[model samples]
Target: MSHAHDHDPTVPREALIAIAAVLLAVMGLAGAVRLGIVPQSANPELSRAAANVAPAQQRNLRFADREDGAVLVTDADTGETVKVIGFGEGGFARATMRRMAKRRMHEGIGPLPPFTLTRWQNGALSLSDPQTGETAEIHGFGADHSATFAEMLEGARS
Candidate 1:
């Protein structure tokens, strides 16, 4: 004779309790931050600390993808093409611009306004979008990636 039984699969009581605890914790943290009980992060571009000092050099630039699959970096003030980074090269710069371009497209914004590239006295590099007020810290990515921007800065000065 075959025994007839129903097998019910369910989460353990411990798991349910743990999940509830985590959910509550997340809600509490969100509430605290929203209420300003937790301080917001400082803007690195404005910070005057030793590691994040004022910009030693700054340039306003715009980037566009060429029909040839290369990135064209242009000087915003002069309306001249500053540099043409090959399709595969300057990957970090290309990616950064792509992210900003996506955001601009989503916001119904055009690419007329330029992005500011700053090299801080403390050796920090940043890319800032004036239209969006968004800033990206370039140095955090590594020397190789940062050099791509650094080279742009040098080219802009020339």
Candidate 2:
């Protein structure tokens, strides 16, 4: 038996257990992500509600569109609603472009299509059709009331 007897039984057991634990942790993390958990490490979480609002407050940002199914942005962690800007129809980019064009701010925002930034009646912000019945009040894009819109508007700017 050429060098075939050099294995340790205890080592295999320990390694197998360790691998199982790692696999579990990975699965849990992936599950969390799929369940609307944003990766703070990759996206860099926004700390405050007023991180990137416009000075005049003429426009607020929004990214909580249902079409962008993977994304789950909010004004605040406890925020039940978000401000919606550029909630375009069609595909994600097409919707954004259409909305931006409506506002007379057409064109891509540094390769990213313009997302519509519309104000809600109650004030919660959102990025979907106002008629869709999924809107909430947002103070405005980058308003003191919401941070998600602020970030989206900033990101969309050329």
Best by TM-score: 1
Which portions of model 1 miss their true places by more than 4 Å? Answer: 1-37, 41-43, 49-52, 155-158
Tens-digit lDDT string for candidate 2 (44-86): 1132233443223223323343564433333332333433443
Residue range 46-134, candidate 1, lDDT tens digits: 46563546678888998888898999988898888778999888888889889988888888889888999988877888888888877
Maximum-lDDT candidate: 1
TM-score of 1: 0.72
* Candidate 2 lDDT: 0.42
Error at 113, model 1, angstroms = 1.1
